[model samples]
Target: MSIKKLQIPTYLSALSVMIFIIVLTFFLIVGKSLLIPLFLGGFFAILFTPFSNWMESKKVPKILSSVISLLCMALIVGGLLSFIVGNVASFTSDFDDVTSKINTYAQRIDEWTQSTFKMDYEIRNKANPDYLKRVLKENSSNISDFAMKTVGSLSGLVLIPVFMFFFLLYRHHLTQMMIMIYRDRDPNLVKMRITSLRKVILHYIVGVGKVMIILAILNISAYSALGIKHAIFFGVLGALLNIIPYVGPFFGVLLPVIYSFLTKDSLFYPVAVIVCYQIIQMIEGNFLTPKIVGGNVNLNAFITFLGLLIGGTIWGVAGMILVIPAMAILREIFDLSNTTKPFAYLMGEEKEKTQKNEKPEADNESSE
Candidate 1:
């Protein structure tokens, strides 16, 4: 074949890939208003599928099953919100006391720094106290602004359960539609790929849900044992943030550290609180996650981390939570095609298995 022929095909392939990426990015950016609720609805629908199925097995009608599942979800969410609100109200009411304790803690830290560093106390005071106070004040305002904006944005999230209900009600038809769309070109391949994608997403959702619940319980227990104020609030916050992947573990640590700094008169308490978070994360990552999630979703550590970073950049925290499952679905689709199988393997855990046996068979066939 002529050089031009080979070059044209390669160039066209590259262009197609680039265009697909650009289109996807644009959709993610512009479709947020519609996409956010739809995505959340889909996610919750999937999570609640088993419950709906169980209700059906017990002779409940499909509509009733969906309604019951949705109501259960609503009750859980309302309970959690009430707990968080109550704790926040109590904490705010005691704000003056908390501020006084924080100031005393700061003084102790300053004294310790002076003694440990053997620095001139007057110079250190001039450099540190003003800057720290200003930063803290700005951070507090920013946090308040962020919370208000989040609440404003989430006011529409009530639509999620509504969407979820219909999704569950007609899930069988939806799956059938999906299969029909892909069946014309390659039915077997399409079905396999879809099945793989579903397994990956379902396993991840169920696994993470269990992990978050356990971590929440452990954190609440630990905080209670340590006599931390607002134990339930911090524990629940940690669990929710943990859904955001890598950065979430750090966020989980930050809540308790801030509480310790604001409520106790010693840096030791904050350090201990941070240490506790680290320990919990270590347990979750090494033990709980591996056992629960297994190796079902095949994205490697680097790609997984990159997916989170890019997803967060594109769609904020919700993106961070959704990206891994989305990527897994994409990987499943790619793995179905001979042309794109390599890309799927690149994002997968089965790289060695994919390489060693398949290539040799292909080489031998070519030689024959």
Candidate 2:
């Protein structure tokens, strides 16, 4: 007599997976303050690995190389922030003018409506020119509260570079530890998969960088042609926000439209801005990203959108930013195991073979 293999019920397997996910989510939410920076650091480490290695090859100590890498990153980020802050300072300085213009516009629209349609354009008593100003004034406390919270989170911000530094310094040790942890599996397969994941992530990042540069050029040209105020500011910012996916592009469009409305003499400018941006958006989404970024990611649109929502819900903006890379990693990791291949398929953009490409079942039966 021979023993047969034991089978786990499908329901039991699914339930176990669900329980694991629930537990993992709970932990992520609980430890997010620490985890967020650590995750960000790990990503930066991955992105900087090649640069770090180049420094090491020149006989620089690992610690010093890591520090140098972090400094480079800081300078890049510092410059971008400086650009935005300097422009934003000037933009915000004219808030009184923005409010005044909006109020005047509201009053004019109200007059037109009352004369033409015989009703007040009754959104927050638009008849009152000061209503818009009052609304902003009333929300000042809430704005200050948000600013305070952002300032409070600088502690976590401070930890990001620290984590990146250590990650780079001990990158080899970390690889070894991972391989040792998977002692039962062939270490070669583990190493191969890890390398593949890094390449994919790196290529995706480089592609994204290219997309940003192209978008920045296009946005600045369009805004400049339209004579939009702070053309460089909006263009650079819009390009930057595209990194966030779904909601990002919307806000990217919204910002210019708001400014155009506030500062321009006519409604035509805002509509023109929207039209120009949409054409550019179509080109970026349909062509640029698909050709450049999508290949490395290999995630279908549905899964990507779902990931963005779940990430946003879990960790707010940071979660949204990190989730795509996390999904890319998980999808690739799933591909490593036969048991997890279905999940990989679910998360990926790969297609199945057509009926015409497959051998018929009747042919197999005849051969058997």
Candidate 3:
């Protein structure tokens, strides 16, 4: 065969993949309004499927079973949101006091910087009426824009539960359709793969949820003991942020530390808050996640970071939340195929890479 013939197919394959990715990314960005809820509903449906299954096994009608399952989930979510809102309301009531303290700290920090480094921080003039007016004037449009966006998102929230309900109702049909799509494969193997996919994905998401709850309890107790204001709010926020991997815990700690610094006169409370979060993070990373989640994604630091960046870029916060489990599901699929097993290995931890490479090196040495 001519070199051109081989090169033509290879170039065509690369071009096709590039085009596919570009089209997919465009659709995802444009159709986020439609897609986000659908994705969320699908995930929730996965989580609630067992409950529906149990209800079906008990001779309950499928439609009623799905409704009950959705209602149960809604109640849990509503209770959690209500609790958070209560704490947020309490925090808001003290917002003026927090604002005053923050301004005071900002003034002191501005003075310190000027004295220490001879750098005049322009923000010190922010307290001036003229400066304040200008700032408000400049930000007025932004504030209005933000409020509009918030209203839009709130409207979107109503559709989520509705989507989730129907997803749950029709999940069996969906699953059967998925299996049928793979009819070219051996029926038993396809079934097993589907089963494994469901089990792994469900376990990963549920395990993460369990870990977050435990972290919240730990954070709240520690913050309470240290006498931080809005301990529940900060703790829960920290727990939620822990959903993102490495960078999240730092942010979780940073926010409370800033709040504690501004609210409390004593430096000790802020220090204590930092120490507490660091210790909690150490425990969670070293013990809790391993004991609970355990090798679900098995993605290396490189792959995880890359996934986070890509996911965050594509879908913002929702993308970050969804990407890790999506990667885990992909890893599971890759593992099932001999051709893709190497790609799966690449996604695994450093130790796996080291071991795999060492085996080949050892074999080569033995032959030598």
Ranking by TM-score: 2, 3, 1
Pitting candidate 1 against candidate 2, the one with the higher lDDT is 2
The per-model lDDT (C-alpha) reads: 0.77, 0.82, 0.78
TM-scores for all predictions: 0.81, 0.87, 0.82
RMSD per prediction, one decimal?
5.6, 4.3, 4.9
The candidate with the higher TM-score, 2 or 3, is 2
Model 2: per-residue lDDT, tens digit, 133-168? Answer: 455445533533433233236767788889999999
Task: Estimate candidate 1's alpha-carbon lDDT, on a 0 to 1 scale.
Answer: 0.77
Q: Name the candidate that leads on lDDT.
A: 2
Clashes of 3: 0
* Collision count for each candidate, in order: 0, 0, 0
For model 3, what is the C-alpha lDDT against the true structure? 0.78
lDDT of 1 by residue, 1-368 (tens): 65653455778988998999999889988877567667777777887888988999999999999999999988987787666555655554434565455556556667887799975455333444445455654554454345433322654366678888988998878777887987676766666665566667888888888888999998998888888888878888898788778898788778678768766766778888887888988899899888987776768998999999888877777678888888888888887789899989889887668789999999999999
